[model samples]
Target: MQKAYKRLMAATIVSFSFGLNHQVSAQSDTYQVVSTSYQKPITTFETYIGNKKIETVRYAFGNAQYINDGVMYGSETDRVVDLKNSKQTVKRLAPAPGQIRKYKDAYYVMSLEDMDHSSLTKYTLDFKKVGKTKKFTGYGRHLILIDNKAYVLADHMKGYNYSIKLHTFDTKSFATLHHETITSMLFAYHMRQVGSQLKIYGIRPEHEEKLTVLSYDVKKQRNVKTMTTNQYVKGGVEKTQTLTKETELIFNQDRMYEINHKTKQVRVLYDSKDDLVDYAYDAKTKTYHVLEEITKTAEFRVKTLNSHFKPIAEYRLKKSDSVSPFRVL
Candidate 1:
């Protein structure tokens, strides 16, 4: 057990003979690695937005969470109160459907597909006379509407695929934005924006030893930068490393994110290790917190970061998950 500004961590997840498959690749210090002393099965996160606790919501895998525009219409008898006018409306949804999210006054749901490459299943409340449907061949479901054109992360090479933005709602128009693959010595990874220009970290399947942490924007029409993860010797091998930005929230493979329109940037402000990273924030906080767990020893670590990506402070948490949402309002 040692600590360094940078060190190689023996990867605890995979250990096998290197002579088997070259896909696992070499283990080295070039790629960034997170200390796995904090390994745990992460489940949920909560978001605090604005200066009010009444404006916050706890989010999990399948729960219909609220948004600034309006509360998610989860139940057929769900209630919504318009804060601007103090008016209320009772909403209904059929089939008790999937996760509903409201953004900018519209309700949308994530219609997940299996990517079998033949047909697609779309989750929609108004599906009678379908306007259009596009096929995306990525690992999960991704679709967003900006300026009226429907963008979908769709079909491409099995492992090399990135995102496909289809121009839905047009009869003659097809896939407007093609597949932008992750082509580099680093390998392919599932990355989302963790901060304006930094903090993109996730569990990398391609890298065997170290975790993948990209200091770029994945939502940008194109990848901002091409950063490589710590190299694992070709095949199944294990190494250990320091808690770099790449390893801070390695357990949160599916970290939630949002685009800050004011700065035209994306931010990954939540994680699974603690409620502080998962909690919401007002625009003025200018600071974010994250948790790195050492499940092997039953100890937890909390990190505080200013808006400029500086580690302002660190806190030692009791080995418990009882930290409540910080009601700073």
Candidate 2:
């Protein structure tokens, strides 16, 4: 009887230890929050923990633009906010109708919605427009500024399918350096600068199982077939990358997917359920933030989660003129 009792206690201890180990392993690593800046008519800065507001800060004037980088910069029609120093300065230039993007030393203003015609304009540090307006054809989004130029993936519709084109222009003079059709796809998934080469990561119509990462050599004015993988073209060749771990984000109508490249497993981080209004991700922090609509209240709660999908922080804000709690720009 004594031996049997001791055996039972040992098994229970082992089981308890296993459970505790699982819980710790499942917990996400502590995400290093770079900074969070969001605003409405008046700008505010905050930190959150799982739908609870920890701290709320308000700026003097203007709608705030939150850039994910640790440095805090906000813009309004008439001014810009330096959150670090808590300073607001009047914008010296004219009002821009489209979105304003700050590159290394200059700011760019362009409208992609003007499908008929569009031009990229440069502005100096003081917000004064600089040089001749750079013009490009068709509807282009996903602005990538690198090496004193602008690279964008554009789309045009045909009879049944769509044509995707990459256009590069000098940021100063807006001169067309390289313009060519890479592949015709339903849509572009992502585009970013990979070292000196511009990489376009997208899915072909029929190749949903695999993603094509196309590398373009702007100087060569041709696609580097070597760097291209999983071409997805019916007759095209395929070169696979030995991806041990990779992350891809896919945004559906109301669902946000975090995809595992090796496993090809997709986890829905945000859904339209629960009256969740909007979601945004901070790449630096590797964290996902969501805004959930509060029930029977004019207040909305903002929740922050780590990369492993663990709750980190939350915040609450009064419903104001600003519909978006966080800005991706």
Candidate 3:
């Protein structure tokens, strides 16, 4: 059963990484940061203006988990870099950093010691260890801050049974507010804040045919609604992007959809023959950018579309020897 769980987690990690590559960057209206992951051990963040590369910054560590402001947080190495200052800070704080969330003046990070042991550690702005929560009995997937509360999403597996745990803590006191365990076959991948509700996206453990969305009310401290839809492509929902307050865009490898949270209405946005690698929305230009791979030509291109999803411009990227995956910030 442990081996089976490991296999399931391995598959989930692969799919999750492909769907939501951790490309954290500092962006502006004039320029965007593009993180490129290759087969090598190095990671590069390139600042680009459309197709023109303006600045390139490389890191020795590869697994950059999170980036905020100008600081890049590395997971395994526990390395943090200030991209603006070109300085690196190494802190052996978390054994295996899962998620890092900055709330107010402190940083809260999730440490995964093993499959059954995870904990939350608090650090000062300068990476000084201040406090830590007790060990949790699951793998911490995400940590989010809402208002004055910090919410943790974790998953636990025992034998053939699976459970999802929601743990809430007060940011000011670090006191436990609520702890709830939900027994289900759903394997959650992502969680986002929509209005006052938390939208959790996951799929059934048995198969990837069905997509589940659970809306949790933070004020009530309970799940308010659950919606499941199998209206995705053959491979299932790969990624999601919030388009509006009421609607979100979900993507498969070759298809994109805009689904309403209230009505559960799904509308197809883009259906392509080629593989769609990544996508982003530019609020300044009011345009959509999608990274697509042309299999026949073995090339990658960025397609820009208007607000109505009409084609505006396209930029072809030069192919490299490494397996470079580009994300538009």
Candidate 4:
């Protein structure tokens, strides 16, 4: 009887230990995702963990444009929200912030002072002001950090003629490296860095039949190639997400295409009936988290896809009139 009792106690102890370890493993695998509404005045930020809604934070000052390391950067308000604790911190250092990039212990922000002027400002991780660049005479649209260099894409107007320019800055010292005009005809919207090439996509002014893609070599510091495609001619490419070092995923309305930069080939990954809002890829689990909007039902669907873009699991969010389309961060 004593031996049997000891054996039962040992089995219970092992079972408890196994269950505890499993819980911890599951928690470690869980990742956080942030989504924001497209409405005005009050910007709502929704935080999710594996298709489950965890927290909703609303900022009345401005829209949150970027998120990094559990902190959300607003457009007009420098607000930071701790995802784990749901605490909000406001810092009014960079006003009218457009794009934010973090390098080492500093944060670089593009501050749009007015319609014609934009400045690149640096701040500490805790939102303390460090320094700022001289205001560029253009409207800064995109900011990208590649290696130790920071690239800013801005639009400049010389009388009625408008030109798109690319400005490069040293990340370590914030020194101006290069300021080059990319195009005088195309209204550039988005850019992606694949390998050593910076691919800029834009639409020709007054001409909407084709989308122009300009490839710029970073090492050579010159325009290398230009191509036009009819794939996303009407509205242009909405979003570009890097899938690998050599390939990226571009979204056009409800369709998603995988483009190989080396071969210059584009392949459709998924043509969904619903509108694809946003998507994110997890390299650790080889999974894709995609968010889609059901137009008929007016609901949002969170989908988990395998490495091959096959749907593995899906969850439908409750319909809400207050929130607009969501973008997975």
Best by TM-score: 3
Enumerate residue pairs that collide in model 4.
none
* lDDT on C-alpha atoms for all candidate structures: 0.33, 0.55, 0.71, 0.71
TM-score of 4: 0.74
TM-score of 1: 0.37
Off by over 4 Å in 1: 1-62, 65-109, 114-130, 139-141, 144-177, 183-224, 229-277, 285-329
Sequence-dependent TM-score of model 2: 0.61
Ranking by TM-score: 3, 4, 2, 1
Which portions of model 2 miss their true places by more than 4 Å? Answer: 1-40, 47-55, 59-85, 90-99, 157-162, 201-203, 208-213, 217-220, 224-245, 248-288, 292-299, 312-324
- TM of each candidate vs. truth: 0.37, 0.61, 0.77, 0.74
All-Cα superposition RMSD per candidate: 16.7, 7.3, 14.6, 8.7
Q: How high is the lDDT of residue 201 in model 2?
A: 61
Candidate 3 clashes between residue pairs 3 or more apart in a chain or in different chains:
none
Error of 4 at 218 (Å): 2.7
What local lDDT score does residue 322 receive in model 3, on the 0 to 100 scale? Answer: 52
Q: Write the per-residue lDDT of candidate 4 for residues 16-100, one digit (tens) a residue.
A: 9978864553343333334455455445656665456678766553356666554566665655443344345555666677877
Q: State the displacement of the C-alpha of residue 33, model 2, in Å, after optimal TM-score superposition.
A: 13
lDDT (tens digit, per residue) of candidate 2 on 1-329: 99999999999999999787545533422222222224334555554443334566665545444342223344335344433354454453433323456788877765544544456777776667788776666665556778777877776665565678887788767888877886634556556665566766666655652445566776677787422233232212111211123655544334455545455455565454434544566666666666666656645665666766666565555566554454321
Could you give candidate 3's per-residue lDDT for residues 35-110 as a string of tens digits?
A: 5443445667665666677887676655555665456665565556555554654455666777777788887778
Greater lDDT among 1 and 4 belongs to: 4
* lDDT (10s digit) by residue, model 1, range 133-173: 44444433233444433333333445664432222322223
* lDDT for residue 278 in candidate 4, whole number 0-100: 77
